[model samples]
Target: MRTAATILDFQHVTKKFGKTIAVNDVTFQVKEGEVYGLLGPNGAGKTTVIKSIVGHLRPSSGSITISSYDLQKEFADAIDFVGAVVEYPMHYEYMSGYQNLKLTANMYPEVTKARIEEVIELVGLQGRIDEPVRKYSLGMRQRLALAQSILNYPQLLILDEPMNGLDPLGMRDLRNLLRSLAANGMSILVSSHILEEMELMCDRIGIMSHGYMIAERNMDEIHHAQTPVYLVRVNDPEEALKLLSEEYGEQLHAKEAVGGRIEVETTLISASQINRILIKAGIEVQEIHEKKQSLEELYLQLTGGAEIE
Candidate 1:
């Protein structure tokens, strides 16, 4: 099987503001057609990293390359492959969406009227394409911004807080759109406070904390790596807890009696073994199932409960 090429590469990149180190020695890569999510709390340097990629802020040291072109050495060539909607989408409120798109299209030599129509349809803004920007909802405005961003057919797309003001339906629409784009070979780097959405949208995620890339993992691997918390219900919860506690002792990671059920957390013992033990001890084993740790739970555990900004 052929490996995908790296679309975005960050090599020991660091960014500082006077005395404050906003980003420190971060190294990661976004592969072709991959959706890479950037996650962090407020002041964790996620914005700093995004700004550095978009050329809004220059790195203090190290290197960054997009689509194989050096960001600092061949800035024009590097930036040509990038399209971004940083912070929030901006447009003239008085002008129509079509007019705004036309204005943005003027900046790119290859953006044609047919291409504009194609993007309008791609973002599901066909009916509202000619509507005044001020008359459009936040979701509509976001769609327009997305349409503008992809007008030049950029190989890499960057989105910062793209779902900030969007509703459930709008969020789902945007998510599906991004998935479709990635499927068609456009690599995306996105940062968001919405962990649940990020978990659903991204193939892999890189977590930042206090300006450091603390953790990076594939979503599939995260799912597989989760230690299962088995919820086992029994006729006698107290007896089951006592028996397991005495039998396992320190080997039992955690054991709690929740109403009539016993929630057991362990990596050393299997759920079937627990069930067999209870059954053999004359304790009726009712229902038992495993609950895996979610992305939000993992994020909280990793960040020490720091609230996502």
Candidate 2:
């Protein structure tokens, strides 16, 4: 049994197409009110997992549960509490945004006009709700897609490539919208190749590659690569670099950085240790501090330089 108080669960799930394995022995849980990320570069089986969870693709083995109901057995009931966008969410281009939502909402008896309006407003498409979908910008279309997913006030939302093709302002707005959804008790799993955005947007991320989940962790755990390295602008960088490379290469990894500064990667030595080391070598320490490990660096480290296809 999954003991993670899960709102969504995938247990030993596997999917195959002829000879190709799209997803293999994958397992993960998304808890309530949390933004979970299914992160990988393209062709990493992220889309397969999302489709399986939403019941669009049945697993070859194991099972799926949504809100504690088995998807295979409960079927409709299990799917009832879920909203999703597998691949790019397709919308009828000729229809008005409101009309498109109405058509989609009619496919399920639980949705009403008020429910549609609520979702439309929530996705920030209310001002343009009556406009034709074809006239909408790419970001607006993305928002409309999100609106379609939320028409039922679903307890769980599964969005694949939720941030695809959005501008800076759109991504920012979408991030805030997702955070707000989690705050109001909605469990969300977003699948995308945009790892940097996912790092900032998701509460925790589950990384998938080569048809399965390779890693999963919170932000702190993912970016724990921060070391005691500082930038130093010295008067004699040539001398400092040679001296440090020759003597302190084991303890202090120093290299020439931009602006004629020396960036050193060192152990958890203190500020005093930095001063003593520089003074002992007759190298004037211009500045010494710490540097936060960016997600891009950590992503490369964790994924082993695997870029999203």
Candidate 3:
């Protein structure tokens, strides 16, 4: 498989606030044309990382490079290829959304009128594009802020809680829009407290806890690496349970069968092996399937069962 180019690189990055360490010796990279998520609970240093990337706060000790330009050394040039929405939407409440975008475009000499219109449509803000920002709903304002961020057609986009104020339909629309942008080669790094949404939206996720990065893995890796558990259906629940218990010993975890179905928790055994054993023992097999672990389950396990702050 061909490797994607690295668009954002954070090498041994650390951020400190006096006696408090916000981010500690963290290292990660975001590749081109992929949606990367920083998944963490509140106070997990996610916002600090986002702020450092956008040049709002400098890392105490580390190197940050965006599109091959060192952020500290070449702030202007590096930021030219980057755009971000650090937190809540900030806009001129009295100005129309269209005017807000137009003013933002004026800051970039290359931003055109057509590009402004295109982003408004892309973010589904065309209906309220002419309305004053103060009159817009929270979700609409968020969308407008997103549109402004992309007005310059950045190579890298960093969003801090991009889905914060969106409704269900609004979240769905944002997901689709982000997918389209990534398909067109825009690298994205987004932070979110919503686990399920991150599971669906991100190509890969980095889990952070308390100020440290605990793990980073793609969805498939998370799914396959968790201890395998399955729900099984058989003719003789007692026999299957007894046989499985005997064969696997302590590795077997048999739950009470409900309606002739049994739940087994084991990592060393596969569905096929379970089925074969039951059939060989004259236990009729009605249905058998593997139960995939939810992202929440894996996340809990990785974080030592600590509640998300």
Candidate 4:
């Protein structure tokens, strides 16, 4: 179980670009050892929120605190506990991966050669650490960037679309790495358009739309929030549908699905109960199971089917 200590807090933060409101009164928190996901479609102000958190842009109103240090008042101190890869991981392409890390390590007084080597190994880039970054694959570069971010052993890490150009293997590797980090007590705030990945990675998610936070929910809560829908395949689907409808009435909705299956929608009824009802009514139940709801479906429902970009 994760602790209740809040690692990062955004309280009614708002950011404006002249006449345009990029982020409006958004508030959320990342607890210690939690992986928090920020999800939204294009033009949903996800970038603005990330920027504000990373100090690229200041919130016009409200407050942001990192490890209890106010971002506006104690900029340096608040940022000390943060490590971020916003938008893209920038590096000196001509420099070797080791060299790039060495340069970054120069910024932190306590980062020793042993610490640098440790991070490289931790990121699984030890073998190719001496290679020029220009020759590294996108995944390798991302790993290097992650190594750089954690060189100082920060309490919170923020990533923006860290999976953008990664292949399946790369994505899996990064996902495992993140989960491992979170398990060891690193709080992460990541923004991404990939709903499936977010669903797998985040403990809780805050969804944004049109510059406003529409919803913030734990993964388990989101899953449970879905109305349980069951697909029942029987000898007589039409009869089963009619029997269910007549018996359950407003308690559930039953309809004929493709392939002569009965699609049952209900929150008040269980699959086993429906099966028993059908069997008791002389209907032969061939199969009965609840249809799992995906995070993409939930996201679509919350965003009004907005295209995830």
Candidate 5:
């Protein structure tokens, strides 16, 4: 893709706070109309990476580009099409929600009051639009934060822990809202501890750990796994087990039926050879398919069983 075609790109980007490398030489690309998830445990360089991309923190080395604007050389132009909420993104507590949105809009040269009201309504805060932000709940604040971010109709929206303090209903609404925004050609980078939500919301996901991008995958790659597992389903499992023991017992794993199917994880065996062996033993292979692992399982396997932080 040309530089302008890519909404965001981090090439060998590294960020350091003193001697601590918060974000290592990370590289990733986000295309337009895609919600790219930056998922990781706490202290996994997630926040640092987001901060670097959105102009809060500069990378110590390497490069980050937003469309045709180089982050280092064209900071203002790079940020021109970007709008974000870095953290809690608190507005004036004493001000009404409408007032807060108005002030935010006023920061832009040509932003009008009507545009402010439009964004507030879009975020579903219209009923309480005149209420003070201090009285707003966590979910309300999040909604307002989103409203502020979209006031510019940003080409790239970077939200850090956007679902931080939202209820289930709010999270669901936010997911739908983000999907709609992406459909409108806005690229988004959302970093949140909500892995399940990310799994549902994002078109692609990148896992970060120990200041490095551990994995990046599209929906299909993230969801459907091609793990080298053999799922053995047979009419006579006892006979089938015995036949397997007589032949390839060493590669066998957890020889038990679960959910009406016998599962085995092994060093990828050939489907034709398995069929031939089963036919020769007269084991009546009802269904013998490869078992694919889920994203959650793959995550645990790769991350040394670390908990989401």
Candidate 6:
């Protein structure tokens, strides 16, 4: 569970490029020790929100607070406990990974050799921490970037598209790393188009559409929101379907016969409830099982079939 303290707050924040509104009246908070994800299709302003937090693009209106420090008024103080990696993480290709980290360490105060080594090990790059970054694979580079972001032991970590170029194994590694960090008390705000990964990684997710926040939900809420599909074996399939259809109207989908069973899809009624409804209607149900929908299905439904770019 996250502490009530707000690590990051966007209070009615809005951003505009001339007449174009990039972010509109967005307000949310990332609680302490939570991994909050910003999810949307491309051009939905996920990147714009992230950029505003890191102070790259100033919000056109409203305010942003980081650990209670006003971002606009106290820029340095607000960003003191913040670390971020946005878009492509640039590094000196010619420099060894250790040397690159050494250069970056010069910019922040109190970052020591021990901290650098710890972050390197934390990102699983101890074996190749001394290699030239140019020779490293994309996954390895992403790991290195992650190491850099946390080298200062920031209280808040911001990541934009952190899993952009990773393979399956790399994505898994990144997810594990993030979970480990969050457990250690780091609050992370991440933006990504990867719904499945977000579903797996995030504690809570805020969805966006057309630069507007459409919905926000925690992991458990998302899980319970998945419309349940029930497979039922009854004494009479055709009669049960007719009874359910007539009783429930369009709310139930009791169709498609499979052997002696009928697969029913419904959002409002559970398998047990459906079974009870049939039993009360004088239909004997032999078995009932609920099928869970994948995160992709839920995402599409929530976004109204708006494809994630």
Task: For candidate 2, give the lDDT.
Answer: 0.83
Where does model 6 exceed 4 Å of error? 1-3, 224-295
Candidate 5 lDDT tens digits, 1-309: 644268898899988999899898999998898999998888889899989988888889999899879999999999998989888788999999988888888788677778887887778898998999999998899899899999989999999998988888888889999999999999999997667889999999888878989888787775665557778777777776677776777765537676555666666467667778778887777788876566676666666666754
lDDT of each: 0.89, 0.83, 0.88, 0.89, 0.84, 0.88
* Model 3 misplaced regions, further than 4 Å: 223-293, 304-306
> Which window of 10 residues has the lowest lDDT sum in candidate 2?
290-299
If both were scored by TM-score, which would come out higher, candidate 4 or candidate 5? 5
How would you encode candidate 2's per-residue C-alpha lDDT over 168-235 as one tens digit per residue?
88898889989998999899999888877998899898888778788887877655765667777777
Residues 47-123, candidate 3: write the lDDT tens digits. Answer: 99999999999999999999899999999988988989988878999999999999999999998888998999999
| TM-score of predicted structure 1 | 0.80
Clashing pairs in 2: 41-308
In model 5, which regions exceed 4 Å deviation? 1-4, 224-228, 231-290
lDDT of 1 at 158: 93
- Which candidate model has the greater TM-score, 3 or 4? 3
* lDDT, candidate 4, 1-309, per-residue tens: 545799999999989999899999999999999999999998889889989988999889989999999999999999999999888789899999999999999999999999999999887888999989999988888888989998998899999888987888778888888898899999999998788899988899998888999988799976676788899999998788888888789999888887768899998989889989999999999888887666776678789884765
TM-score of each: 0.80, 0.76, 0.80, 0.79, 0.80, 0.79
Worst 10 residues of 5 by lDDT: 259-268
Report lDDT (Cα) of residue 138, candidate 1. 78
Clashing pairs in 4: none
